[model samples]
Target: MIPLAMLAQFRALHHHLLRLIDGLDDAEYRRQYHPDLSPAGWHLGHCLWVENHWLRAVVLGDDRTTRHDARYYQPQYSPKPERGARLPPRDAQLATVAAGFEANILLLADQDQRLDPTHPLMTDHYLPLFLLQHHSQHLETLRMVMTQRALSRHRHAFHPQARLRATPVAHETVSLEAGDYPIGGAAPKAFDNELAAGNARLEDDTIALRPVSNAEYLGFIESGGYDNPALWDALGRAWLDDHPVEAPDHWRRDGRGWWYGIGLEGPHELEPRAAVHGINLHEARAFARWAGAHLPHEFSWETLARQGRLSLAGQAWEWCDNAFFPYAGFKPFPYLEYSTPWFDGTHYTLRGASRYTPAHTRRPSFRNFHTADKRHIFAGLRLAF
Candidate 1:
């Protein structure tokens, strides 16, 4: 059980989500994206179900509230039906979700912080925060899905969906004995996911740690950086070809003008020093290669994470070259079905949570991923040498 205050916050959160989905109608809910992501309708329902399942069935007594579809909710299988087969209509979906919400919140009321303790849902201290982050992530996904559904005219409406998305991640910087120092967070550990190797020197030395800023990447753009194939990997080059990406997805410069983007700040002139967000690992890798730099290993991020430096964790995801895989000694704990199927080396790892990531989901130990080819969500990169 989470604190009562947080439970209230969660309740309010659900309301906000409902508001975010305000105008979409029944026909719009069942629409699907390629086979990987869920349809907006089922996605929203399942999002509600996940929390309900944990609190109602798994956490509190097996308070089986609404029937949860094991086939659809199982996180193990990829390429599953978009949130499962079509539904009984949008009204039914909303009512079912509403019923689940009422029961789930009661279970969380005045609850123990360590509600279930051993449950993967309970052990994570940051679960609530991750849940908040995750909700925003899906909200963005839904927004994009709707926009791509030929509703480009409605794009203006989606910008505000991510407004309250800043989450706090702890960071710090510490030096290591240089020379190929061991990198990466606890193997399969999640990004919250760098460092330079100078060769063994004094331990506990200090170093500078910062999220990659927009100005740094803007310089890459101003210099015709993407034109050089040397800066791109084969896949990155292919992606560039297929997409014809001039710069960041929402970026534009008019008449030697200052940079601008569609972000929480609305359409403000781009700040170069702000972390260069919304780029996927592939783009980050290409950018680093072009600049003769390297993406820091988990070691650097963990060091920086320890330093409590930049406000990462909840603001946006930090790209790392690592792929999401279990540790050598990984044992299936609370959610075997969730992480195992993704282990076939199909996705790239990212450290830290973006404002859109669920608060329950963001943790230094939490590793999130997508294919290197993806750049749709709010992801950014931190450079290292």
Candidate 2:
């Protein structure tokens, strides 16, 4: 069961996300960083969409309640037929978020006596609890977008890819023994204890020294890698049906040439050796299948990471086939609302640290995971037989 304190943490997170949007205007709200990112106003509204969808609709079993009201607020590109204000003005959206926040606190109060431990919502903190974690995450994206737009004039100077080129990779294959590994973050402050108690584990399964480069990934694409049904699973085929993927995320063709945003330069030429990132697990798994291989499991990846043999802690974070789950004999940390809830599902695991990962965040034992469809983040994958 989640402690009262952890529930409080979730409530606090609600306010924090609300604060990021404390003073948004119509122009600012409509700003779109990328098509994948829901506009700020949409994101703000989605924070409530789940609460209403899950709590009032799913949790309370009030099936008649219309959840599409939340969708109306979704600032997506499918076109809002009822244009102008997609949201219930600013106050209504804010009120929804506020009400959702307060309702979560009430959920926590009765959680000890009336809540179902096995409920899917509780499994990952139910809808109400998950909202806090969910919103906190989007806040980071919204904040970055706001900062970028506010400083649009300086965009040319601050791009990550603009500063670096496709440099040669220094590290080589690193390896670790294979086993089940816990994936994702520790408690807010558990890293200190993880180190102090020697609970964290690092493995060194041989990992590629560099990211799967663009040229190599493109080779997969050119081979009709996306079309080969044999290369995909049931769900993967479904994804391919709706989404025509080529190369990686944020990529497009300009006349005879193809390019992508490497965090700068307005779509520079694609590099061949700099790890094929931005491809989702469906794409990665499909490519692996064509190559007579499959994605590496977390234990396999961790084995590579712990060996300290590869420089992945610097160049990039690598993906593995394993889903993120708690380790054997693992118990919930202070804010039990975090990782445990995601264990039962199809969350994909990744290893090593990215440049964005803090030095202290680096660990062979650390497990990171996301849904197979996610590609907007700093993620890439490695292949193994």
Candidate 3:
């Protein structure tokens, strides 16, 4: 039987997701703010689809299909760019989602089917946990979408006198002794890519105690870090050739200095102590090179995190140097598409949690991946020597 705690958590997560898009109108809800992100409405429907597909359909052995339009809701069927246009009117979509949410609650409360010992997903209530984490992840993405919307709508009301200089913050290092350290996660809630906990050897290296702040990154920018080809890798250089970015995403300049735009309340003066975010792998690598350091390997990062040395947790997602590859005994769980397809060497692993990342997904072994050139994610870097 599903635990009462799991059921309560499910309701809380569902409500949180709904609250994210509460003030958005039909246009805002259906509008695709970024090329990489699905519309807010699409996220709502897709979350329902995933919950239904796994719980009511898979666990309960119900053959009945979801009433919502599959083409718009199923990611495999509708591409990211096309999802916005395909979304139903705002009220219609919410009505469908509300019905689905009720059904999901009932499915979670049902003790008879959950008691089936033969189902691996139902074992230890993994399915409910997975669904909750999955829902939490999409809530993060919805936040990204909303951030993009706010940025797109912002009109720069520049005030030259108001331009504030970023305060200089020093980077401090913590040295770890060379040894084999336990990495990956064996917990039931761990992602498939983080499964079958293993050990990895680490060379004696000094890693930054905290993520690089905006002030340090600003020095890199002013030094023409982007113009220096030697600082970037081959793919990074190529990406730069196509899309030359002068600064981090959401940063704009007036006649006097730089300002950072956050979700509706920004274009505020940049905070020096704050971790630099909205940077992709390329930018992170470039900054590391400029600082005469390197991005930490995923193993090294996990080692530091497990030892409780990573000081700035939940500030920004830290980019790791290594490609996102599977652990030695890796096997896909629940679905093949989740982690299997992303194993291509192009994707890099990001460690730690962003401010928007949910508590359930904040474990050290939880792996987040993205391609080199994508900067829409709230990511930053730390230097390793």
Task: Provide the overall lDDT of each model, using Cα atoms, as 2-decimal numbers.
Answer: 0.58, 0.58, 0.83
Q: Name the lDDT of candidate 3.
A: 0.83
TM-scores of all models? 0.71, 0.55, 0.94
lDDT of 1 by residue, 1-385 (tens): 4666777777876775665454667766665643545666766776786776665666665645535465465445424464535454887877777766665666555354436656665555345544555565666566555434442332432322121221222133334444333333331123222111122222333332666567677667666767878888888888888877777755644443444666433344555456767676767887777656667655456555644654444566787766776654455534555556667776877777765555545545456768876665667876665
TM-score of 3: 0.94
Over 182-259, each residue of candidate 2 has an lDDT whose tens digit, in order, gives 433344433221322223354444455545666666667667877788889998899888887765664555433445
Report how far off residue 20 is in candidate 2 (Å). Answer: 11
Which candidate achieves the best lDDT against the true structure?
A: 3
Off by over 4 Å in 1: 33-36, 55-68, 73-85, 110-151, 154-208, 252-259, 263-269, 310-314
The model with the greater lDDT, 2 or 3, is 3
Q: State which candidate, 1 or 3, has the greater TM-score.
A: 3
Model 2 Cα shift for residue 19 (angstroms):
15
Clashes of each: 49, 30, 0
User: Could you give candidate 3's per-residue lDDT for residues 260-340 as a string of tens digits?
Assistant: 546544456667778889899999999888888899998888889998998887799999999999988999886898999
Per-residue lDDT, model 1, residue 174, is: 37
